[model samples]
Target: MNNQASRSPVFKAMLETEMEESLSDTIKLSDVSHGALCAFVDFLYTAEAPLDDDMACDLLVLANKYEINHLKNYGENFLISKLNWESSLKNYSFAHQHNAKTLLDDALSLILDTMDNLNEREEYLELVEKDPRLVVNIYEAYYSKTGRCCRCHQS
Candidate 1:
C-alpha cells in the first residue's frame, strides 16, 4: 500500500498519522494493518473481495474518492450485498471530485437498490469527466439494441 500510495495521485488521500497515547499496557502491532488495502488489491486483481459491511463501506468511499474504479466497484458490490448504509456523502463528494463515473453510477445504483438515500443527492451531472469511449460503447450497444443507430442523431 505504501508503494501504491506513491503511485496514485497525491490529492486522493486524507492520510494522517494520529496516535493514541498509552497510559498503561498496550500491545503494539509489528506492522500496519493491511486489511483494507489488501482487500482493495484483491478487488483490483479478481473483482472480488471478502469484506464485511463496515469495512466494505469504508474502503468503497476511499476507493471512489481515490478514483480507483476497480476497488470501488468491488467494495460497492460487497456493500450492496451486505446492505450497508453507513456510507456517507463524503464518499460521493470525493467520487464526484475525482471524476470516477462508473464508480458513482455503481454507488448510486446500490443506493437505489437498498432504498437508503439518507444523505441528500443533487444533480451530479456537474461531474463532467465523461469518458468518450464509454459513451461510444453505450451508444453503440444501446442504440443498436433499439435499432436507432445513435451516432446518426449526433449530426
Candidate 2:
C-alpha cells in the first residue's frame, strides 16, 4: 500500500483496498499534463512545487481535483500575487472554472476597477465572443460593486 498518511484525506481515500487493482496500485491522471502531474506528485511527496503562472494554473486544477487544499491555496495565492490588468480577465475566467475563490474575487475586482477601458481591449472582445456569460457576470459584478450599470459609464 502507498504511504498515504501524509497525503490529504481525499487522496488517502483513493487508496482504499476495495478499489480496482489498477487504481489501488497506480493512479492514472490522463487529464493532467505530464509536467503538472510530475509537479503534483512532487508536492505529494515533499509538500513543495515550483510555481509560475502556467504551472500554478495547471496545478490548481490538479489540486482541486485531488482535494489538496494546501496546493490549491498555494496555486491561488501565487496567481493572485502575479495578477495584472493584462492577465486579470483570463485569470478571472480560470479561477471561476477552477473554483479558486480568492483568485476569482481579486481578478474580478481588477476587471471591474478597470472596466472603463476593458471593452476596448482585444481580450475583452475575445472573452465576449467565447463566453458571453462571463462577460455578463463581469457587468453584474461591476453593478453590484458600484451600484450602477456598466453601461452607465460607457463612452
Candidate 3:
C-alpha cells in the first residue's frame, strides 16, 4: 500500500468527520476509541481495500456503525465478490438491516432456492405474511400476465 495514501485531503476530511461523530459517543461510554478505526477508514478511502479477514471485519463493523452506506455496500460487495457459504448469512443480514435492498434481494433468492425444503409450510406463510408486499407483487405479476396468482406462485 502507498504510505502517502493516508495524506489525501478527501480521506482526511471524511476521517475527521467520522471520528468527530463516533469518538464523542465512544468516549462518553469510555470504550477507548482506537486510532485504528481512523487508519482503517483511511485505508478504505485511499488504497485498494485489504482483502484480509481482519481488515474486512473492521470495515464491515465500522461501515455499519458510521452509517456509511457506500462503504458498507462496498464491503458487502467485497465479501460477495469472493463467495463462501460460511460468510453469507453474516454479510447478507448486515446488508439487509442497513437497507441494502438490492443485495438483500439477491441473498434472499439464494436462501430460498438453496433452503426451500428446510422450512415448514407454516414458516413460509409466516415469512410471506411479514412481507406481504412480496406476495402482492407476485400476484400482480401473475395477474398482469394471465389474471390471478398461479397455484405454483401463490402464497
Between 1 and 2, whose TM-score is larger? 2
Where model 2 places Cα greater than 4 Å from the true spot, the runs are 21-24, 149-155
lDDT of 1 by residue, 1-155 (tens): 44444333532233322333122222232332468757666655566777786567666666655666666676655544543334422344444555545544555444444333332333222222344343244345445545664657532
The lowest-lDDT stretch of 10 consecutive residues in candidate 2 is: 1-10
lDDT of 2 by residue, 1-155 (tens): 26742365654666665666336566667898889988988887887899988999999998888788989998999999999999999999899899999999999999988989998999899998989999999988888887775677542
Query: Which RMSD values do the candidates have, in order?
Result: 11.5, 2.7, 7.4
* Per-model TM-score versus the true fold: 0.34, 0.87, 0.46
lDDT at 94, model 2: 92
Provide the global lDDT of candidate 1 against the true structure.
0.48
Instruction: Judging by TM-score, tell me the better candidate of 1 and 3.
Output: 3
Which pairs clash (backbone N, Cα, C closer than 3 Å) in model 1?
none
Return the top candidate by TM-score: 2
